[model samples]
Target: MKPLVVVATLCALFTLSQQAPSKDKCMCELTNSEKAFPYDKLGNLEGNAVKCNSDVTSQKARKLQSLMMGLERRLPELAKDIAVLDSENDEQMYAAISLQLINNELWEIQRLMDELNSTTLSYQRLSASATQQLKGMRGKMGELEAYDSMQVVKRQQDNRRLTRDLQECRTGHQHIVQPTRRPRGACPHGKFDNVTGPRVNTAGEYPGSYKYGAWGRDPRPAAGTESWYWRVMLISSNKYGHYVRLYTSLSSLIVGVSTPGNILISPSNPTTNTIQGPNAVMYDGALYYNCYNQDSVCRFNTSTKTVTTVKLPAGTRYNSKSNFCILDECYLYTDLDLATDESGVWVIYTTAQDFGNLVLAKVEDTEPPQLGQPRRTSVYKSSVSNTFMVCGVLYATRYIDRSTEEIFYSFDTSTGEENFNVGVFLHKVSPNIISLNYSPVDQMLHAYCDSIMVSYKVLFS
Candidate 1:
């Protein structure tokens, strides 16, 4: 029965992970329990991707990734699908569906196996694990052939929901379209041209102690604090913070105003609802940041003193799995960047499905808050130093030197066109820009660079 459970769950999750990525993936408290599902042996499937040979194996590994994306979605449906199949008096249909599930996967494996036999350089494909999976699959193939004569496919479809789902697992992996383009929205502030200045640069009240965090003005504020600015310093391991400091104006943020208004995430325990990573954004009197120790976003309303959350995709990389990096070292806990632009608020991060390429999700300004249609980008997350969205376009920057940063790439979510040479350079007051945020209302790009806060005048065309 243990083996029966494993086999049925695998096929079911393959069906579940495919139930439409954007529309269905907002686990939002309603589906939090599903996040605890364990992958068990299937966890090692991604390990094979790392062992891929650059020639033929690389192409096949990508194919496997596509199939796994479908698999990851249905994975949560594992238990229910298993119950559907396991309810039978006898689990005779197991071998048939296993063959259906493993067939397409075997085609890719068999191709690598052919390559292994032909080239001496492909010795890694001949490992014991690979050989065993192939051997077991071949045995299932022999069993599946007899089921064809028995009209098993037609019979299974007549009575159970699990049958069609198992069949989808066999065929659904091949035709997934590239989700690179996003529908263009209005960019009233105009297209980005250049950014000037380290206009207001200074280490705040904490001085050089806090090296990584985010500070910026809320493009849409509550009432009369249009000139007000906010700062969130990642005081714990450059990754977590328990509070956000508020300044009445830009001068106060630059001069380190003492007794600045402070908002604590939790009154009883500072660690609860603490900010995670080097990036966060304050919008409409609420603070949005990566939820502490979880792959979800936490929204803390300053006025109500209440919190709400939105969970990212199951495959989203968090807790520093995909952070910004340069040639020297990577920034820790710099995953899940929150940005504000002329259009609205958005979150930028990467997922395993996109092969770790950057993914963007628009955050709606509702009471409980919800995630909008997600758009995928071709840019790799770790390849850039920081990112900010302006007028619905995402711009990525990389480290240059202590006095400069280069805006080298841009991805327009509206048309899915990628421009590799934006070539806009930003003058810096400090070496590293840990967090970069664009505020549409003021038309300013605020940067938190190595304990210093700086603002720039964004020049648009």
Candidate 2:
């Protein structure tokens, strides 16, 4: 019986030792241990394994409770951090967008500023032009009123004379009103003694009549026509009026400054006519001057001493003071104002609308010669110092001083070339230039200044 009991005990110990361990303790080695453990042995140990049952109890319940607590504490803090990051991202995005919008606005403002600047400049130019035009219009209106007054006075005088003449004719039985010939000095304004046409008589065309002084603006006489003529600026009439006296082969130059002097030449009847004073020029036996209205140029015959109208092209007007010039022939060179540039580089000096243009026209002709269309030369936009002509050659100077300005240009009817330039004060040096008979008769230019007359010889090749 004792042996049998010991055998039972040994058998039970072997059975317990043969039981499979729990999967938690042998996870990696379970597959390798599969052959070592028998399925029948695992079934038998299930009911008898008391120590294995206590050790294999589940710990998932404790772990799950701790994990829940940790998740509750950290998840809210993470959510707050995510919210802050989202807000910061949104702010950065907004800042970038705002910066872009500001840049766009600034660009627009700059573009508008450029446009406004351009518009302002244009407006300023337009305003200046309008102001100038307004001033010109006002001046013209005043001139028109003066012209109208003169016309009224002349008409009244004409009516009164006609009425008296008609009454005399009816009362005296003068064959039904035949107008009687009035004697000399009968008309208040000088009578038209004889209205004769232009005469081309060579007998009367010697030592051409007309003397030019400071204002030397006229066509020079042809060579061999060297006769001394006296120029007198009569203060007899209006400020614009003067008389020219011409006497040929006279020993003395009797300028009418003091009194009417004697003439030795077998005097043909000396003629007297009116001219604009101070700015008078003698050209080719005629006295040329700007008319009183300062619009047209009038030519008075030094021999006949008669005034004739010179019709110029439309839109042209001469000045009463400092405007016109003489080229060659009887041709005139007038300065006209056409246009000016943005920088005001070409500011015209004359009161005439178009100044600084070259107007070439004859002055001392009896009848208005059929001069072909006048040629309009250089718009010489800059100011001019002086202009003179010699032997069909035109001369001009831009500046007066020598150190600052240096150039002398001589142009002819055909070819023009700039010949020389020098550094000398042209203004300090006197312009003793005068109208010469063809070439300078004495090969010299004379100008009256500071009391006495200054004369000098100009070298012309």
Candidate 3:
């Protein structure tokens, strides 16, 4: 019924036919013993050697017959079971084969045992060769495992070293990154009311703390009893301009000049006949200021009280809208629409913005001398809308630390200097001020705190 069974049956029929004695046996020729000896190489023997070979074949054939008989009985039952597995499902096909394969393997083991008995000496050689080959294979397998383990260890160490080096390099770079240093020093506070260096103190008595503002520039010597050393000035909150009031020693010496009252207030609007204030600088007895809502710088003669206007460019940040201050030869002031960290300082007379930029040009001369843009400098946290110069250094009131107010220190018109920082706070007392201004007569520094101003006289060796 099955192809394997049909083939096996046909092979058995052929084997039986070979064993049968044929009637044509008279036509066959018999070979000698010597010829039969060489027949061993041909795998076929008919004489003495054939007898020996036949004995081995007979024994093998007997064992094979027994094994074939056992397989024949078991294979049929296995086939019936396999048929049941196939009927169950395709997935059970492998299970059926596995179950039947044990019988086939048993049959093969029996056949191998028979062959081994027939060729006992050759079986020994095969076993010895197989054992040697197994030993060689085991040695190669051990070497591979050892090499793999060493490679793993080396890779781990290399990774750790690389990680450590990377971390060290990162730390080193952070340490050396950007270089910054804290600025150190003090501000120079000059002696008030003493006349040794600049102001003449012929009044003999020092005046206490009082509010005195500037009106234009009062550059007059002490004379009559009513004459004052400084003038009181005011910037009107109602209008965008400045005004001046004279505070002579004569007023204080005769009637005792009243402070908070001695200063003048800006006149009410629509008073065109009265003078409006601008930033003023006194040079050779001439006071210069800007008129109300005007771009031209106006000059006032102190001796004759004559007024004249000079046409000038409008300020950048101040379009008749901002306050202004004066340095020696330049007008130092801010502009309109000022930037927080980058406010503009417009120097009108000498034609240069001192703080943030340094644009220097002559106001009257037609020949422009290197008229270029100012260099950039960052401002402190607090806004520095005003500044004053003492000695050669400039002091601007701006924020240094975010928590407190500070005065920034710097010297303009210097060469190759980059250090600028918060110099002093109004609350602190010190032995040294950065740029101290002393009175020409009695030298002392006046430190003001609210209403009480303290005078310190530094006797420097």
Full-model lDDT for every candidate: 0.74, 0.37, 0.35
Best by lDDT: 1
Q: Candidate 2: deviation at residue 292, Å?
A: 2.4
TM-score between candidate 3 and the true structure: 0.33
What would the per-residue lDDT of candidate 2 be over residues 1-461, giving only the tens digit for each residue?
Answer: 99999999999866865686455453233354223334454454443344334433344233333333323433443454344444544336433433443443345345445655665565567557656655765665454445454377668878999999999989887556657753422322221111110111111221222222332212355354454433333232223345543443111222212113221121221213233433445556555554444445556665564666554566554432443232321212223211111111011223344464554433324366222334334534233434444443444444433222222543333343333332212222223222211123323233322112233223321
Off by over 4 Å in 3: 1-227, 235-243, 250-286, 309-315, 320-382, 399-405, 414-418, 427-461
How much lDDT does candidate 3 score?
0.35
Best by TM-score: 1
For model 1, residues 199-301, the per-residue Cα lDDT tens digits are 5667867878889888988877878887688988876677788888898755456556633588888653236677888789988888999988788889998
TM-score of every model? 0.59, 0.35, 0.33
User: Over the stretch 80-168, how does candidate 3's per-residue lDDT look in tens digits?
Assistant: 54554455443554355444444544554466456545655554664576566557656654544454533776688789999999999
TM-score sort, best first: 1, 2, 3
Output the better candidate (2/3) by lDDT: 2
lDDT at residue 377 of model 1 (Cα atoms)? 83
Give the candidate order by descending lDDT: 1, 2, 3
